[model samples]
Structures are given as C-alpha cells and as structure tokens.
Target: MTLDDLTVSLRALRLLAADFGHLPAPDVDVSTVFPERLRLSFHDTSCESLAAFEQWRTALGIAPDAVEARTQSEGRTRVLAAETSFAGAVVMLTAYADQSAADRAGGVR
Candidate 1:
C-alpha cells in the first residue's frame, strides 16, 4: 500500500495499528475491500507474540497521527487497542493474545 494513500486513509491506518509489530515488516499483503476499505495481512499470527504495531509503523516512518493506541485490562486479560476510523466507521481495533493458546504451543507464559 502507498504510504501517501495511508496518510489520508484513516480506516486503513486504524486497522494497521493493531498489526504493526505483530506482523512481519516490509512483507505484507494489502488489498482493497471496497470503495474506501483496505485489508492488510502479514506473517506471524501466534498468540504468544506481543508487540505494538505503532512501534513498527513509526520505525518505518509511515505511521499516521490519527490512530491513538493504549493498553487496558479486561478482567484478567491485557488487550492492546488502537482507536481510529475503519471503513468509514469509528472503531477501536483491539487484539488479545490468547495465553492459553500460547501454553498449548509450548510458549512460556
């Protein structure tokens, strides 16, 4: 996806926020889902991996100012959150790493 386009595409920017450090850098698939919607996918979907997407985006020098990120606790779960526009709708992209899934994968908790 074009960085220039991303600067103006708030929806795409928000979706990407939750996927920054979670996905492999410089090697991802981007697709347009509709008139103003986009989709991005990358490697590494493990529940054990934990990282902020904004860090990766900032490091790449392509992060937008529209997305705001923070961490919060839902009962006993820690969820990563990115609030922004998605597909013309205001939404918060939240990702929860499944510690149980990580345990099943032999990953240290």
Candidate 2:
C-alpha cells in the first residue's frame, strides 16, 4: 500500500471505530515507497477490542487465510500479532501488554 492507500485504509478504520466503538484507535507510521508495511501499534490493548477484531475477521472468513504470528514475550510482557486483510489491503493488528509492563518490554510489539 502506498501512502495514499494507507490514508484511505486508516480513514475506513476510523469510520468503523465510530460505528462499533470497540476497535482500538491506531497509531500508524507509513513510508511513501513500495513494499508498504502497514504496522498498527495498539498501545492500549483492550480485550474487548482484540475480541472484536478477531470476531470480525472470523465472520469475514479471513481468519484462516490470515496469518497468525507471535511477538517476543517475556516476564510480565505479552505481545500478539493477528494479520488479516481489509479492503484487499494487508492489515496487521499488534497489541502490546498493558501500560504498566510497557517499559520492561521496551514497547516490543
């Protein structure tokens, strides 16, 4: 996805959040070139939001197609990665542990 594509995708997510209200707000950073990496870092990971995204992906039947991966987790830190396509664009949801453990993990997600 190009920068423009990234913008449109984020707008769609924001709109979806408005409707469902459980989707976690995204903090995105994108590059302008090809081989775009759309990394969505959710600082405040909530169980409800994670479940909502999982259910949404499963309902779309993309869960199986979606790649499930794990991030580095140790101590009191936890990280999860769920990759699913949205509007034909590859979207990755990365959730880090709660605020308290963020420091030790060094924002590992």
Candidate 3:
C-alpha cells in the first residue's frame, strides 16, 4: 500500500482502539524493530535493539528522552519494523528536511 494509505490505516487503527478504551501509547521506544539503524534528526537519534541501547547508553552514561517499540502483524505474520527518535513527543518522517522542519514548527495538517 502507499504511504498515505498506511498512515490512514494506522490512524484508523489507533482511533478504533481508543474507542474501545484501548488508548495509544503515550511514550514509545523504537529500539526493537530495526536494529542498528541510528536515526538522527535535528534534536535526537535512536536505535532498534534494547540490549544494544542499554549497553551503548551505559558506556556513554547519558539519558535518552524516550524509547519506543512497535510490531505490525497480519494474522501470524509480522509485516513491518521501524524506529523513532527518543527526544521528542511528536514525530513525522518526511523525505525533505525542510518539510520535516516545517512540520515541527507548527501543526501542518
């Protein structure tokens, strides 16, 4: 499916879950979906493995803003994997840095 389709589906999933009193996660640690992917944005970076995150963080002895984990499934099959930064409450991925920056600047939707 297209990215827009994926987003719409995800949003609908969250809303439907919320309707049943199953709210979305307030905080997410991305390290468990795509290990080794160090995503660096303007203010933060993240990885995908909890063990790796802990080891590396211990070595450096610093605090991350947050950590998130997600898993997408279809029946018994896993379909998607990803990671997000730890320092921000909100996140949006854009192909263009300018667009991402603009998105962070204000509510663009």
Candidate 4:
C-alpha cells in the first residue's frame, strides 16, 4: 500500500471505532496499518477461543463498496472508502491523516 492508501485506511478505522464503540464495551480500535490489522477482541490474541479466529477474519473483510474519497484539512487531510462499487459489492476503502497542522491539532479523524 502507498502512503496514500495507509492514510485512507487510518481514517476508515477511526470512523469504525467511533461507530462500533456504541455497541458495547471492549471497543475495537485501529490496531495496525501497512498490513492493516484490526484487533477484533478485547481478550488476548493467543487465547483459545472457538470463534475468535473467524471474527478476526471477518473484521478485515468488511470493506464497503464505492470507496469514497474526501479531504478534511486544508487539502492535507484525506479520507477514503471502498464504496466505489455498487451496493452488495466489496468496498476496498482506504485514508490519510494530516501530518502537520497550523495549530498542531489533528483532524477530527
């Protein structure tokens, strides 16, 4: 993935966290990028859980179609979605967080 792709992915995950946190405790946060890993559980990764493996796979696979792209800061912040395709199709969403800010404030996410 390019730097641009990594940014898009970051914003997408931030959005996902905000959206998902409303469900319950054990909020899912953006775990990693480059390879794009999302921590699917609050428990340990090595725990011997029957459904953990499948859950992890599902989190990485839920890209929505029509990956929309948008900028947040003065052309610095960028966001993306895998929603370019029609509904029911897989979204290959991706993002970029602004590196510098005049006020040193990060974008809204």
Name the better of 3 and 4 by TM-score.
Answer: 4
Task: Give the per-residue lDDT digits (tens) of candidate 1, residues 10-106.
Answer: 5555555555546544233333333243333222244332343444434334346543433233233333434444445333333444344444455
Which one wins on lDDT? 2
* TM-scores for candidates 1 onward, in order: 0.27, 0.48, 0.19, 0.26
In the range 1-109, model 3's lDDT, one tens digit per residue, is: 3444334334433443355333212222223233322231221122223333343333323345333322222222111122343222122211111223333355332
The residue pairs in collision within model 2 are none
Which pairs clash inside model 3? 28-67, 28-68, 29-67, 29-68, 29-69, 30-68, 31-48, 32-48
For model 2, the superposed segments whose C-alpha errors exceed 4 Å read 1-22, 33-37, 45-74, 98-109
User: Deviation in angstroms for 73 in model 2?
Assistant: 6.1
Q: What's the lDDT for all of these models?
A: 0.41, 0.51, 0.29, 0.39
The digit string of per-residue lDDT tens for model 2 on 10-103 reads 6645544666465445556444452334556555444444454455455435554454534443444345566655554455666554434655
Off by more than 4 A, model 3? 1-48, 60-65, 74-109
The residue pairs found clashing in candidate 1 are 20-53, 21-53
Residue 45's lDDT within candidate 4 is 24
RMSD of each: 9.6, 6.4, 17.3, 16.7
For model 1, the local distance difference test gives 0.41
Model 3 per-residue lDDT at 52: 38
Q: What is the lDDT of residue 29 in candidate 3?
A: 21
